[model samples]
Target: MADSTVKNTYVKQQITDAMLNLLRTNELKAISISHLVAAAEVSRISFYRNYTEKEDVLREYINTLILGWHVEYENSDKKSEEEMLGSLFAHFSKHGDFYLLLSQRNLFHLLKEVLKTLYGPKPEYPNFGAYVAAYFSYGLFGWIEEWFARGMQESAEDITILLKNRK
Candidate 1:
């Protein structure tokens, strides 16, 4: 029983890793069950045993990423607002291709849901503060996209400085 459980876990991880790799090279829409199974070196039956569809795998992947981020931040000492923003930006920057793929329309909605789960409900800010936070998140995503587009021209520190100084 233990061995079977271990095998199941390994298979799931393999599928997840395969999907991530495909996302790195292709748009999310281009990923299919056949491609995932082939990449994972598993049969279609094995893939279905773990996930019903590609979106299921992608949902699980996003959830895992968000949960991992939550744990990392939860374990750390208090961080300033700037530090928090920088850390979040750094996380997305590290996964540049993944973020780029996820920044698309449908996937970005899912990303926002994951962010809400990780960070809780958006804070209540008065007037312009709310607009600022919204723009901050949008701008942060834009900056990361620009980095990936330009082959990461500036360092994360430079981007963080730019974000901080944005009026």
Candidate 2:
């Protein structure tokens, strides 16, 4: 039983590495199952066994990345609001290419899901906490897109300062 779980983990890691490599050199739209299979050095059957489609692979990758951030935020008692924002910005900056590609309107829904998981369930329509979470997630995504498009000229410190000063 444990052996199968370990093997599955290994195969998933291979697929993730292949996807990251392909993403680095090509647009997301350009990546196909054949390319991913070839890069992973795995058969089509292997790829299919793990993922239903390329979109599934991408969804898994993004969710895993965001979940890790959520876990860090949840576990840490010392992270101030500024530190949390800085950490989020730093993460997006490190994976700017991935975020830029995943910054479409549809992807914001995924961000919203992550927000719900991180912040817990929203209240009624006028709930301030819910509103803030939605605004922060959506706005932060837009901010990341603009930063990447501009070649990320600002340092992380500068960006962190900007976030800190926001009302």
Candidate 3:
């Protein structure tokens, strides 16, 4: 069981790496499964076993990054809104290159999709709480989208300061 989990993780990592590398020079639409599998050094069977489509690889990678951020945020002992904002900006800044690439490729929607998955309205939430969650998520996503559109000129710290001051 452990071996199977390890193998799956390895394959997924390979696919994610290959997809990111390919997206560096190639449009996502231009990338084919054969090319992706060959670049990943994994067989088609392995690719199919891990993912159904090329976009899935990117989505999975984005999800992993977001989940990583979530874990860090949860464990950081952030007690203030400013600290939380700092953590958020820092994480996004750390991966600015990949995010920028996604923006350039018109694939920022993938990030938005992941954010929706994380913060979208939930069945468990009351009606008001669900709308509030969706509202906050969409608003936060809009800010990030604008930052990317602006070429990310401001440093992460600068962003944290700006938002912190706005409150």
Q: What is the C-alpha local distance difference test score of each model?
A: 0.72, 0.73, 0.89
Q: If the candidates were sorted by their lDDT against the true structure, best first, what order would they fall in?
A: 3, 2, 1
Please identify which of the two predictions, 1 or 3, would achieve the higher TM-score against the true structure: 3
Backbone clash total for model 1 is 0
**Model 1 lDDT tens row, 1-167:** 99989998889989988987887778777887888889998889988887777878878887887678767876888487667767766777677667666664246556665554444335666767666666656655556556666666676677778878986
Among the numbered candidates, top lDDT falls to 3
Off by over 4 Å in 3: 165-167
The candidate 2 region of ten consecutive residues with least summed lDDT is 104-113
Candidate 3 C-alpha lDDT tens digits along 1-167: 99999999998889889899999999998999999989999999999997888888888889989999989899877968678778877888999999999999999999999988888888999999999989877877887889999998898889888877775
lDDT of 2 by residue, 1-167 (tens): 99989988888889888987877667667888898988998788888998897777777887888878778776878478788877877777777667665553234345445545554435664687677877766677566657766667887678889878887
Model 1 RMSD, rounded to 1 decimal: 4.2
Estimate the TM-score of every prediction: 0.68, 0.75, 0.92
> lDDT of candidate 1 vs native?
0.72
